[model samples]
Target: MRKLILLVAMLAMVLVGSVPALAQSTLSGDQGANPPESDGGSVRGIITDISGSVVLVEADPSASSGPKGYFTVTDETEIARLEGDIRIRASFEDLEVGQQVQADYAGPIAESYPPQGEAGSIVILDEGGETDREATLSFELEVECDPPANAAFFGFIPAEGGINAQLTDPDEDGVYTGSVNVPKFPPGPAPPGTEPVSLPVQIVQVRGVIKDFGEVKIDGDKTFKATVSFCDDNGGGSGNGGSSSGGGKTLPNTGGVLPITLGAGALLVAGGLLARRLGR
Candidate 1:
């Protein structure tokens, strides 16, 4: 009986000692798995492809160069979609191709030609990092004199190329009618770490570019003006959305396996103690 009790005590000590070892092993395994923790870096680019949980990004999109590397976004990653004045919390599944994103690393990037890293957070940005809203300007010009062939229309509007449009005279009438699609760009730069603010543009000028039309008139007036509004209700926003000034921060690394490991260790220790008591 004495020998048995001694053996049981020894066995109990061995089990107690093994528990911590097991726990340590479990912790190490949980932390050491592939796609290691990010040391500290970030990449801002367009997401080109998504395979399973991995996302391929094109770091130098301006040159259409090779994809920089693959980034994996896990459940811990924080994803946000930014519109002009709205922000939506999103997930990995919500990610899609052709969208610009700023990805923050969750671990040290793999030192490969095309690097690899885990995404700690992702923010979807609008194309060109600017809010693009479109408006339409329509006008009709009546020529008092004979019209010239191959004549074009121009608008003194707030847009690129001076808001140019083509006027087509379907009938033989002297009235030439056309509409210009005007895109509204942000009036000014956005505040640092914020979205660009959009204001209404009350009025713009539309004119006839008829160089040979001796006289051009609209509503018996020499010059024509159109009212323009950039309100949200008028569908003035672009479908691609807007840019994000500041993106999400990195999240703390955590593991669910630790709790299960601790529970198993506790059970082993309890079983060992119970056996020792029985031996006594």
Candidate 2:
């Protein structure tokens, strides 16, 4: 009995230390099918409120159908404010209520009660009704995926009305269509004499995780025609407007941290059980 007691105590201590290590070693280099592919999507609206990395966008009455979606802004995400002529780099610290913005996003949005995806870029469409010209950002997503997903969408907030495109499994192949109506602001500073008041139709930007991404050519296509335009009054520069970078918050790795923690927890439980059995 004494020898058995000593052996059990040794085994318990080994578990207390070794189990966690063994689990980590097993999971360290894991290459399991790389988490599900997050398809491309977008959300546009007013920054009605904000908290953490995700900000709430409130839509006006003319906006399209769909619940107000929350978008996750990442450090890699280009947070830029459109001054008179430039897309100046900024961050969450520059954002505020009533400001109009367009978020181009991709990847899987959270599956919580209200789904939210990460944003790759957040463009401050306008600082404050500085311009009356409505710019449209129109792009068609030619999609191709191995396994089909039920739905994917891209959205944009006009200075007044918001628009979003919803793509689903194609009628023929795995292809789909989507569009965005972004309230137009100047892409960059132009000559002081000419103000753009014409409604321009062109492919401003294309974002998505569609396998074999289709060509999004920016050849200054005919898509750019200004129905109405605004004169360049302010040259482009970064704005001090944005939500704090969470003071260098760790929202980046939040997705991968869960599995590691769960593994550690399981190991601790196993260790406790082994120690209990040994005591008995």
- Top-lDDT structure, candidate number: 1
TM-score of 2: 0.30
Q: Where is model 1 more than 4 Å wrong at Cα?
A: 1-40, 61-67, 128-280
Number of clashes in model 1?
Answer: 6
* Lowest lDDT block of 10, candidate 2: 228-237
Question: Would you list the C-alpha lDDT of every candidate in the order shown?
Answer: 0.54, 0.49
Model 2 CA lDDT for position 85: 53
lDDT value for model 1: 0.54
- What lDDT score is found at residue 141 in candidate 1? 50
Cα deviation of 174 in candidate 2 (Å)?
Answer: 76
**Residue clash pairs of candidate 1:** 37-107, 37-108, 38-106, 38-107, 38-108, 39-108
Which candidate achieves the best TM-score against the true structure?
A: 1
Please give the lDDT score at residue 208 for candidate 1. Answer: 18
